[model samples]
Target: MSALDKALNYSKKVGINECEIVFIKKKTTTARITDSRIVEIKHNFDEDYGIRVIHEKKIASVRTTKPQEIEKTIDLALKSASGVRPRNFWRGLPENIASNQLSGVYDEKLHKISAKETMDIAQIMINSAENSKINTITGSLNIVSENFTIVNSNGLNVEDNATYISGIINAESEQSTIPVSGIGHVSSRTLKSFSPEQIGNEAQIMCTKSINPQKVDSGKYSIIFEPYSVGELLAFVVASNFNFKTFTEKKSCFSNNFQEEIAVNQLNLIDDPHIPEGLGTKSFDDEGIKTQKIKLIENGIFKNTFSNLFDSYKEGKYSTGNAIRIGSPMGRSSEPIPSCAPHNIKINSGDRSQEEMIKNTSNGLLVGRLWYTYAVNPIKGDFSCTARSGIRIIKDGRIIGPGKSVRIIHSLPKMLKNISEIGNDQRNVIQWASLPSITPSIKVEEITVNSI
Candidate 1:
């Protein structure tokens, strides 16, 4: 029997009313690049098990890396449960989980990749940037394989395997004196779709374009946000506004706006977990609930919010299969308990191409990426962020020149409503410590940009 099975059986023997155990194993290969060369390669292997026990509606959880310590961990969890107050809204663990397979989420070759191979890929990326006349290239590549097993006292048992490859590359122009830089990134479930060369080339091109940048006056002006910037905005500022817990507690800006139009009539957003090769694709969520596509906004109308088991129970709703545990830096982990989070947030593509959007703009700023983005006042949909790199000014539907960093203070709801155009060129992107998203370039009208 697996550790999960043994733990569940032991919990039953100890008279625990209900329990769930999750086991996770991860293998990771990482390569760090600096100054157009491979600097280091590291390999890691980790395994951990987490157990949750419920006694008379009280819940407690414990995690441990040592298999031999499972018994002690259970005892600790039970002891912890004793002091906790019973939750009247607590519902039992999910049962009768169906076995389903998600395509493009697992690759045997990724599991077999070696440290040398990862390093070689990293080297190729650096070389590509150097060949483009970049003075410096720096980034990290991570290849991960994960194994998961879930078991509960309700006779639910399931296992899943997945692979991921992700990288970030930055390039600096050789002739630029202002320390301009560009960044590119990629994430995929298989090595076949991973492209280190494309990442490097993109960074190099952006860095070259950003040399000797000028400063634009701070004022209200139209703005174009590239795919990466859109990902940053949504992941950090917008996604949480649809959390069932936050909505139910009246802490979200959209709390009372359900079924109302909150954005442009052309806007549609979906939380999809079954997208092929998507970074967030999964067949089942952390609670062993089947995952499905959820239309968060349909034609600018707020359609639904995401919920995990606990939050759903609190609101007397069913789980949306949005239960998630924040993965470790290297990959998946069993250390954290489940919470509500988006899977793959897909902003439906629009009709206009990026070039068309740029050509049609009379005067605006194009932001390639956003830095240090956060919600200044979440309840009011107020957001603040910095456009630090890859910024360009547009004048009379022409690219004028690159611009220096600028700060933006905007309202999310107002910005969404002011969207004038959306590009069809969607790209998959994940911001730092945020959810994965697929987005395209979007143009918004009259945003507040401030000099900093």
Candidate 2:
């Protein structure tokens, strides 16, 4: 029997009214860079199945690596649900939703991307940097083979599979303007399908920019956030904001601001998992819900919030198919029941050039990325973070010098209102996050920049 069939038949047999199965399999390899060369490599392969059952107002989750364990797990799930307290706002499970067949996000050739291919690319990066006075090179490649099956007790079944190839490169330079920069990224379900030369050149440029970073006095200024740097902010947004649960819990700033034109009426933020070959691409979500593109911010106005099956049932809204289960082998958690979260949050890019935006600034900071950011209040959108790689710029378009641990304390809505410009430059970033969030570089006029 198929995974969906297994989940459905088991739920009925166990006297449980509703159930869902999330089945996933993955294979991957990763390599690290040290002393300007690869010093380590690791390979991993994992396969597992999890069942979540909601019966008689209670929910139970169980998982097993071996198929033999599925029956026991199902039995345990039903028994556990029976004895447990009813859910806080218990509602019946959902029917399996169907989705439009989309292309460009899955690859049939991902497994063919060999270890030899990655090793060759790593060598090229090292050689290029060494030739440019960038005496050292450090980087990594992550490739994965993933298959997923989502099924529910309701008439729902999904079969999805894809491959992913991604690379992260970091390089340091002898100059100071851009001392340490080299954020490289490419994702597709296929091997060697991304541009090595394009990403390589990016790393080279960022390293060069930081080599001799300029510095200016700390104060209010116009700030231009590069694409990779903005990605850090997107990660935070996906993690804390835009969730219907968070909104109901009074933990989201966008809750009260819905339909309000908060930004420049030109900016939009969208979460999309349907892009072909995208690392976050999927045909169905954790709840066996079909997925689609969702606009969180439309023309600078806050749009509707996202609700998963269970959450929507409680919130009295239709599901938006934004059910993401993070951190455990492609959404398979052996121990914890997965919660619905966002997959890809992208800030629509604006039309201004990076240089033009910089020149428009009389005095301000130019941030490469945000680091160590934390929320003071998700409802109010207050955040505090340090500038990771950047310079303080003055009116004449001159960057003064590189900054050290510069701090920025600001509010999200206020910052959006300060949108003086958004650059045409964009990038896909995977920072130190649970999952990478896609974003574009942006600029806001007169954000209070301070470091004493």
Candidate 3:
């Protein structure tokens, strides 16, 4: 019998009220780049089991790498459950989960990719960023393939196969007055959609253009945020505001704005789990709940929030299939307990192209990337971030020159309402150990910038 079945039967024999076991078999290949060259390449294989047990309304969990000790792990979890407070509202685990395999979420080439092939791909990234003006290049490439299984005492059993590949390049230049850098990144589940050349070429071009940056005067100007920067905003600032728990607890800025217009009519934000090649795409959530597309903001109105089983049951609701056990580097983990998160935060594209958006701007700053982005006051919707690289000054519908770094202190509520344009150039984006988002360039009007 499989370890999962063995654990489930053992839990039942031990008189446990409920039990669930999550098993993960992961293989990862990675290449690290530094000083304009490939520095290290490594491969690792790991297996882990996470077991959760419930006795009379009390729940506990334990993780183990040794499948042979599964029964001992269950015993520990049962012992651990005795001391925990009871949750009378806790509903039982899902039973008979049914889900279809999603297309483009797994790739044979990436799953069995050799280290030499990985090095070759890394070299492509390094070669594309090579230029006399570039002083150094740094970034990483990660390819992950995982088999995830979940089984519970309620006869629930689900398994999924997934693959992920992502590459990033950061090119630095000291040819100008001060050190300036540019970034390039791409992520996909299928190798056909991944582009190492684009990653390098973009970094080279941005770094080359930002050779000599003029000072950006402090003032309120229209700002255009490219996809990467928009993804940063989505991951660090915007996403949490729609969490069901956060909203129920009155911690979200939009807590009281349900069914109200909170953004421009051109905006539509969704948590989509079935998009092709999405990093977070899967047939079901970590807890064996079938995944679905959820509209968080529909045509500017606050529509819905996402939740996992525990948080949803506490408030008499159901899971949105967002339960996740995010692993290190990338992909899912056997974390015992699952937390709620979006599958993929996607902003529906508008009709305007990026060039058209830029042409319409009379005076603006084009920001390509952001750093140290965080919410200053989440309740009040205030945020702060640094525009560190790929900044360009626009005057009379023309990009005049690159600009220096600047700090922005803005309001999310105000920014959403002031969105003037949303570009059609949507792309997949994933930040390091953060959320995955698909977004496009966004233009917001009359935002203040402080010289830094």
Candidate with maximal TM-score: 3
Q: Kindly indicate the candidate among 2 and 3 with the higher lDDT.
A: 3
Ten-residue region with minimum lDDT total, candidate 2 = 327-336
Global local distance difference test of model 3:
0.94
lDDT of 2 by residue, 88-122 (tens): 66565567566554575555555655677667766
Candidate 1 lDDT over 115-186, as tens digits, reads 878888887777666645467888999888999878889998888899988888999875765788898888
Give residue 154's lDDT in candidate 1 (0 to 100). Answer: 95
* Number of residue pairs clashing in candidate 3, backbone atoms closer than 3 angstroms, sequence gap of 3 or more or interchain: 0
For model 3, residues 340-431, the per-residue Cα lDDT tens digits are 99999999998888789889999899999999999999998999999989999999998999999999999999999999999999999999
A best-first ranking of the candidates according to their TM-score comes to 3, 1, 2
Model 2 spans with C-alpha error above 4 angstroms: 2-7, 99-101, 173-182, 188-193, 212-215, 327-336, 390-394, 398-401
lDDT of 3 at 228: 95
Which should have the higher TM-score, number 1 or number 3?
3
- TM-score between model 3 and native: 0.99
How many Å off is the CA of 87 in candidate 1?
Answer: 0.7
What TM-score, computed on C-alpha atoms, does each candidate reach?
Answer: 0.98, 0.90, 0.99
Question: How far is each candidate from the true structure, as Cα RMSD in Å?
Answer: 1.2, 2.8, 0.7
